[model samples]
Target chain A: MRKIGFSVIYFVLVSVIFILNYTFEHTAMVSYSFWNITRAVLLIFAVIVFPLLNRRIYSIAVTVLKEELRKKTLYVIFIFVALLVSLIHVFGKIAPANQHVFVGEMGLSGITLFGLLFGVFMSSTAMYKEMEKKTVYVLLSYPVSRQEIVMGKFIGNMISILLFSFLLSLIFVVSLLVRFGPINSVIVYSCFALMLEFVVIVAIATTTSTMLSSTSNIVFVIIIFLLGHMTEKITHIASRLEAQRLKEAAEVFVRVLPDFKRFEFKDALSLGTVIEPSVIIASLSYALFYSAVALIIGMLIFRRREVDRL
Target chain B: MDHVIEIKGLRKVYRDFWYRPKVIAIDRLDMEVKKGEIFGFLGPNGSGKTTALKLMLGLIFPTSGKIRILGKVPTDVRIKEQIGYMPEESYLYGFLNADETLDFYGKLNGIPRARRKERIEKVLDIVGLKHARKRRLSDYSKGMSRRISLAQVLLKDPDLVLLDEPTIGLDPVVSREVKDVILGLKSEGKTVVLSSHLLSEVQTVCDKIAILCEGKLIKEGNVDELLTVNGETEIVASGLKQEDISRIKDVISSSGGKFISSGHPKETLEGLFIKSIKEKQESKSN
Candidate 1:
């Protein structure tokens, strides 16, 4: 009954947002984008898939989720995003002709920025906090294996990040609706792609966190995030160089870094370009494969790492 | 014949970042704890009591030597189901309330929901924290946190329990209660390995003890055997006058025995504190 009550409250909150969007549509025509539809579908899929995990893994994930919820970081981010969306009128006044596009871009950018920041920060600190607080001692003393702990933290943090993405997407969607009747397909795809990118970033953060201090982990994750985003550009510039050795070195660097461009559909979204379904599928698959490899590496390192430092 | 814990030449050397040996926390030490015994591990700070406990729990890797718990390698995950460990410090998640903390650990041990709930209540009641189970650990006093830690240890009713300094930082009354709980566990035929620097506490409850100094086992034997004086004896007689005590001493001297000393027996501060508190509680109830 408590769960039902919470669900009803959530439903009512969403309905209120929808009603607000409808009311605002009279002043400015609302438009729906393909990206918006894709995000809604993806979120629904995540909601269904997360619960199917093993009980032990699911319990760990829920613990991590509860920890994050209690920290109130998610609420703070949501409130910040809410305030940012409400102030989108400033952007609209700046560019009247492309007001809706600008609004969508700002919303997507805000979600992407906040999502990446939270993902990297949370992932890097999750294991470190456990160790420093010696909470991991109690956890590791159980029958649970190291792999389960790593995987649990990853999945738990991933779900929290996804929920964050979903909330930001809703705020963006509402902002778009207020400015323009319906959101474009590009906006939805952009947000989805951003979420995929966050998955990869979180995996990197979790892996680094196994071996590095929290501060170092954050620095390393940020460096990777920047390098990942620049992989294509760096390779492109490298190919244009005269020296073959330098080009080869750049190629290795690019291959070593995560190709964040694969999921970076924001530029295309801003240009109002239609994203291919194959590209979306390929991007999602790449994110999953990369995330799996990163988590596996983290588990391997964590299994051998001595947790008796305290 | 039946050893619940066996360590053969176990050595743990912590290394620095450059792979240089930094400290030898545990030397080539060996010991065995028999089943159903409250075996006390006595050592001072930095004497490797904690290091040894961590090795036994497989929390750290041994630089050399071997440890077996329940006839399996220490690292065996399956063995942990039958083992419970309460560290020297009450290292609990501060955010979780006592109930949530127990529930979380119960889940980690893979206890079924119904059984876990039952055990949580039982353990909380045993630790006298049933009423304060909803209070966050951060809000708990040090003694309360230690009680919760002990409750979590017993939540699964493990066969082999390792308690490191269980009475450390606790009041005499609470400490006596913890000792009684250990005795209770012993009564149930559970094998307990307790480590503490409190000789008095260890003396009262430990059936056998191993004392370590500078990472070496300096002494090992039954508490009574190790503490018994070969040529002297202690006599306690209440309601005896000073003349009666003098007469008893003269009789000992006449029996070809040297009279060492004779005086009123002194009660340990812990014992006195416990008695006072118990009396106060009884009077309050009455």
Candidate 2:
């Protein structure tokens, strides 16, 4: 929760810079380029707030590393996030001229990819490792609720991931400022959008991990991510299917799947567009709604779990 | 006086993909431990001893039973503050040294800094791990890590302590030291529930014994009463001949005593090692 609070604070730093830039630039309207800054803000906002909405990720991590501070696995994950962010930045640099996207938009995407993957990996293994090693039995004996134990693990892991994400984003931002002379408002908005999207994905991963094995949970979360982005297409195919009943089922699936397309504020960033305040507010609401639902489901599953195994 | 723990008809059924019928891990178990007593739970593998302990600790809920620890439900956060536990397996963070781990747990229980420091040092001394306090948990051997975990439970000076297989991996000397620690806790009027498979370990330290088998209670009573009632009557003859063994059994039977076995009495390895360590300690104290 601290990490989430801090991340939210860190995200607004870019917005502050944008407000200052707008004061000097004499912009008549919050220009198309302002979308970039909004997106950046959203990305950070989502990462911080998402953990609170669905605690499984944060709780699992906390449980794993709370007592021991020296597990090199945490440091290794840091290195992995750093390398992933750098690799994404490199890929963004080599894109074709026609595909020239803003660096802020590119950076947000990198955060979502790396952050979500790391979230799932940590969440899935948190309780599984404790049970396998019989370490969980110690905590179970305490009068502490399973919720506290699960929440502790998720919070602990979230802090680590937040550290990694923040460090990587900080470096990316620094590089952007050095190359582009103080990233415009366009980058901030782009980052914000990415943060919001990653939160939803993190929640999905966390919720699945309570019931599924580590590897299976990761696979399940990845599939959800993939399908989340194609709900519209699914709806389209459902309309065209030969069987009417099948099409009806597909429609229901579309409604239930997270509308990953709605999270796409990148199109606005590409044109350097200013996102309306309403859109930002709406996107946040969606992220929060998804997070709440996912967490409720995760909690229900966890409530019934046999503590002996974990 | 508040009973530290009370359970009525505790039962646990584990359902997994691998098993056809759900595993009845615990069945209709009823027991209680008073405010301050060294209570031992004894059972063999698959006997539901660990299951019963887990239920009492409220690590997992009983399928159809009720348990109260310290006058509250097992899952009550308030009760957790007053309870300390050492599991059969160490669940410590491998990154922190012994001292750091203790500090983390102590703080969680809201122990103030200065007192936490004193407690850390004191508990490490009790567990005989003061020398290894600086070593990271990952660097410690199995026995060392277990000792650190034991130290962690005691650091909070909890009102109730639940220890499951607390001495499984320790050396004989260390195990004896742990026995002494348990005795010390008993003297302080702290309730201590220890679960172990070694009958002798319980026989030496436990005031009361609860024996479980196949998820059912086979017997439970004070050590003195149970031993007097169920223990085999023995006769020692210094100059008995081989043919006299049969006669000895008949004579014992006629005397209303059941003769179970005859053998040369020898000190067990663990017993000898513990005796030697105790002699050294006594000499040092003198």
Candidate 3:
């Protein structure tokens, strides 16, 4: 962690000097402080995506995903994420919304999308590919527990996402500092919260994939992500219908489903308001709770899996 | 002698998706494979040979009964250090080259780098894959992939080796090479439990044999003992004429010998192929 933190700080310092030099050469009219502010804003956006970009796993579950995604077949996904980030930069010319977007938000959103795509690939292929290809047998024959394999895979995946977000976040921050004002810290925290939401979604998707087909798992997770934000509204609608049983069931479902809206730090980003520490802690705790449950369920299903058939 | 594997009333029933027919993958199957002997497990397709292997490896849990491998429970992590397994299919990470793949498995087995390099070289040579060292597994043919899997088993140098159809799709030449590798493993004082449908291959390699069908152990014993246990005899007599051959069955029956099958003097296809190749080499030497 110290090494990672140092690298991030070093990258920011280097970007600040380079961006300042470029700003003076191109726009001699702009003041030094203005250039400094622009670099700071950009760095803030970069921070959003930074967590995903680093090449290491913070935990064990993410470590397995990191290893799996390291396979050359999955390199294309990383390229696609980089491409999307560059395209988002291009879009800044057309819409002012692009300018208001935090580098972190853009990056976290891009990584979330990439992570989901990778999650689909991970969840669908995790057991099925191993079983079909007979790799599961070799893996199972090892002294490692089945739960460890599942945990390792999940960790590897999460870590790959982190690596992507981290590196891409740095790239994004450097780009931002070159163009806009300095990045604010509030946006950084919000983006981190958003990425955690993505992790929660991935965990659920992974659990679903252990039992369902690839196509079905993707569809199911997407629906969960979509409807997850509307839990409060869904509950309200159930109450308006005046059907007590339906309302009760809807309330129950809403609690069971992740309230992704809570992790959407977009409101705080747009308003430029600092999020309360309690809010951040609460959201993080919720994500952890969901992720832990989903992982446990996935392991249970995987333990019963026969390697002979996918 | 210590038994490397012990089984009692082992059963596995799949209940999910399909109707609950209680398909017995291993039905009260009881057997023991002693240490330091090559035990051949033979059964036709869908006869639960593979299932029994899976259960023993703890890849899947048995619905009932228990299995012990290397004096520990099959799934016990401690026993994993003592057992190596080569599955029927060439299931490997296609992205990694042979060297990287071996390194990864070696790491999983807790082998250090210096010793791992020495062991990797030895096993790669054993599997005859020293030349194609840098090629990614995706580029490998089915035979090469199988050889790499075999190399992984050898790298561990475990006390017990379980091979499922070790030479299923290999050409005659490669198959013989693989057979020799298995034979070499036995000479190292390692116990091997292998499953194959090839009766002749089992006959040549195994000291003890177990025949399974429909998830049940039908027969098992020393190869020679089982053959003679039912008083069935096979004779290879070369000097008999046509009329003498006809009378030979009666002579044997009258002499209290039970004839299993009678045939002309002809070697097995595998035997003839091996013999002809050897003869050509001997003739060249002369």
Candidate 4:
């Protein structure tokens, strides 16, 4: 229903970004284009509209944040990530093309894998637990809107993931600084890129949690994450299809799905190559755009849902 | 009299996720509650008593027809400001203690800090949970959980309170206290709606009663009016011999009034319970 329309618009926009990026690469086109403008607009909305909305969502968010912290989850996952990455410093001892570079690569990869796992796990289970315990009934019995509940959980998980990301980034950044001599753009951009992925993944997990079981949501969001990074390969495979109609359908599929490959900052991160600002802005636009659309969809689905335990 | 709640042809048909009809939770039904009355919603196990309450609170939408609370639709957010709902289960977050739980709800209702503090203390005192205010709800007894949830309903001093099976799992003492609170709510001019399977307990407090059987309203009326045996009267007297009783019956017949058979009225279970506790206390003191 409404989802199909959003998919179509997203597909067209992604296709346009691909065409313009290609043109800008081959010809004398400017850097500022449709994607850049969209990024600006979305950022503006995030900066302006979210705070206004947060007035109502803040209390719920604070409670959610407390719930997250009170659980063994924060301590369990955070310690696991920190300890696992610290052990990477030992792995650098065994294989060294420059121990620092190897440590940085492995540590960044650890952050990426564990960060997504943290986001997916928290968002999926929080929704399910609330429903199973029927606590959502008491929460809804308040004057808050369903939209606020969805957004509150989203913001709450985001703030938590942000805090988690910051600590991990500090460990990664300080280690890199001590060895490599200063804070590199690669480290900064990688953290930001990983965070953008979190925004999209958390939003997707939260949305699916409204309709699907938490187990299914974890698997579903993970598959999307994997497929999202392969947009380039999928698009290439679609382009080489001999059948015309099939190729067009496949192309539509690729465009409609999110492009996580843009935020593939890990590749540049490991290789120490500079990521383009255009790509950064493009991914930022897509993250905010897709997350908003996903949350709007979640609010719609949840509003119609019966919260009664019968 | 102004109605605090109204239902006109309300029907709720629940369906499975695959779009197959599972149960007609509520068939075409209509009911109303006047302001400042304690409404008794009664039924057998599967008579949709809970379903009806959930529908009234906008927790579930009706399949057909409408429900209005205080002159606005059930789903209207503005109407929620004056309505308080407590579901069949406690459904409260176990991670929070009483103060935090009440604070979360109070903040959501946009109550200010000082006022929320004042009301929290007031409600805590009313529910008799003030001593355990710092313990998490997960650790509280079933009776304690029920009381704290009631405190949440009373926090905002809502005009219309919807309590679903408020005495479902409580001990007799706590249950009596809840009925007293319902009566107190009426004295303050607030309409209170409650559903329970314990008809005797509800009978003591309800001003109006509606009985539902299988999603249909079977009967509804004022408590006294519905239960009264019309055209008959019973007389109770002590120290009456057999000849005296026969004489009373003769007098009733001569007066053209029906005489109903009667024995001494038994004490209610709650009354007996209180009596025993008082006696035990007195004996222990002696």
Per-chain TM-score of chain A in candidate 4 equals 0.82
Question: Over 4 Å off in model 1, which ranges?
Answer: A1-52, A241-246, B238-247
Candidate 3 chain A, poorest ten consecutive residues by summed lDDT: A51-60
Ranking by DockQ: 4, 1, 2, 3
DockQ of each: 0.45, 0.39, 0.37, 0.53
Question: Compared with the true structure, what per-residue lDDT tens digits does model 4 show for residues B113-232?
Answer: 999999999999999999999999999999999999999999989999989999888877788888899889989999999998898977888999999999999999999999998876
Candidate 4 global Cα RMSD: 4.8
lDDT of 3 by residue, B1-286 (tens): 3999999888877664665755777788898988889999999998898888888888788888988888877767667877889988788787778998887778767788899999999989888899998898889999999999998998999999999998898877678888898899899999999999988789888999999998888998999787664545566667778798779879888998766676776667776787788899899999
Ranking by TM-score: 4, 1, 3, 2
Interface RMSD of each: 4.9, 4.9, 5.8, 3.5
Name the weakest run of 10 consecutive residues (lDDT summed) in model 4 chain B: B73-82
Q: Which stretches of candidate 2 lie over 4 Å from their true place?
A: A1-109, A182-184, A239-251, B16-20, B229-271, B275-286
Q: After superposing candidate 4, which stretches have Cα over 4 Å from the reference?
A: A1-53, A276-281, B236-250, B253-262, B278-286
* Candidate 1 Cα deviation (angstroms), residue A170: 1.2
Q: Quick one: ranking by lDDT, best first?
A: 1, 4, 3, 2
Name the weakest run of 10 consecutive residues (lDDT summed) in model 2 chain A: A2-11
What's the C-alpha lDDT at position A92 in model 3?
Answer: 69
The TM-score of predicted model 4 comes to 0.89
lDDT values, one for every candidate = 0.81, 0.70, 0.73, 0.80
